[model samples]
Target: MFVPGTASRPPAGMMIPYTEQLIFTIATQIPFVIFFGMGIRNLISRGDPKALLFGIGGCLASAYEPIVDVMGFCYFPREGNWVAFEAFGRPIPIFVPATYGWYVGGMGYWFWTVLQNPKTTQQEFQLLWLRAFIINLVLEYPPIYLGIYIYYGYQPLEIGGFPLWFPAVHAASPMVAATVINLIAPHLKGVKNLVIIPASVMAYGMANAGFGAPVWLALSVDRGYHVSYPAAAITALMIYTGVWIMSLQLLPTQPLKINGMNGNGKSKGLRG
Candidate 1:
């Protein structure tokens, strides 16, 4: 029932002090940053260039969330809910981008992990989508419950105060990142930092713009909330489903080779 581009004050009773908000922001973002850092290091040390590239791609892709949020295409309503610093014309927490990086990187790593499992069968590919959904719920529900942020201004169907389409959206993102990275990995065998890094940013942007533009437009223009939930949900589902199917097609059938040493710094097989 919220309107895009319109600012709203937090409900009086729900407002938390800036200090508390900062604490929450730091608490949530640090773990993701650490985890992503560790994963990136492991990938790099092992010379698993493919996994490293995709992980970075996911990080870059997720960074777009904050940009869109600040432009008023979406609303976070974090002004009173947290200590805010202005960027791109909106008061947002500093950790917003980091949290997104964590999410996308974490999810990308997850998808990579699943694809690399030696015993995984083609039938198990379907499980990637399921894992994406579960991960989405796990990551989002806590923030919603804590009132860290909430969608406003003409959201679609929701579950427990979060948009129902979110899990699908979240699920689609890593797939898009993975598909882009996988398709381009061969050409990017060397100088990946120079080429793949920028390419990943552009690919992520294009994927989000292509898939998310309709949803954004639908939400933006229909300030009256006239867009039916079913219509919106269907649109989201179509986009996500297409991405999921494309990912299944692009994913390598063979188990991936892990590059780094095991716990004792000893090399392991592809199953590692």
Candidate 2:
């Protein structure tokens, strides 16, 4: 029994117009689609079934958003003309999940790329985390600013009206993805469709535990459905960072020399 409250509602004049939303939605999705396609194609061509499976797993993980939307944990305002559907009482744009898939899949490919290079050190991992934070700031902040989606129930510590920990959550996602990819790499290389089971579990677990739990708990308190910003923010940071650390711990002690053929194939040696 969570209510998103008024903060979740878009301010007057802030809601994206139907036409603009449609245009933006399509435009944004195009690049991600292209990247995902290229990544998949490259994996296929390079005979890297393990990487391909990881990418597919990432896409599947992104589908968890629909459940979040339906549960009233988050809101994506509708542009009247966009294709719409309902699940668990939530209205969603068709393209929203597609974009999410691209994002997650793209990250999975990135993780695969990182693993393929020579041995990675803690310093390199830190740099990669910084890069993810910056990238999320660039990509995610705008949508929040534009009212593409509103955080209704919980008001975690925010900058520019969005949770401050969001970028960190974004940053951590690839690490979790990397963990999943590396864990299944060996088995997936030899088994066809075997990735489907573990990938499904990881996707669902990560989405629910990593993303959904913190928000849910923040709203569950006596304050009703409003976000306990501090608690929520802390929970997000902890979960995300913890997962990221776990991923790092789980990484291979020695990096595998992946040839340059797949999407993440560019050889960038670990910087000194």
Please provide TM-scores, in order, for all candidate models, with all chains considered together.
0.70, 0.72
lDDT of 2 by residue, 106-215 (tens): 66557656765667655575566567768767776666666577765445666776655556655666666666656566565456545643564365456456654665
| Error at 258, model 2, angstroms | 34
Pairs in clash, predicted candidate 2: 8-152, 153-227, 154-227, 155-227
lDDT by residue for model 1 (159-179), tens:
677765656655666655555
Q: Rate the local accuracy (lDDT) of all candidates.
A: 0.58, 0.57
What does the lDDT read for residue 207 in candidate 2?
A: 47
Residue 264 of model 1, lDDT score: 53
The TM-score, computed over Cα atoms with residue i paired to residue i, of candidate 1 is 0.70
User: Which candidate number has the best TM-score?
Assistant: 2
Q: Where does the lowest 10-residue lDDT sum fall in candidate 1?
A: 1-10
Instruction: List the candidate 2 regions with Cα displacement exceeding 4 Å.
Output: 1-16, 50-52, 70-72, 78-81, 190-201, 204-208, 222-227, 240-244, 247-272
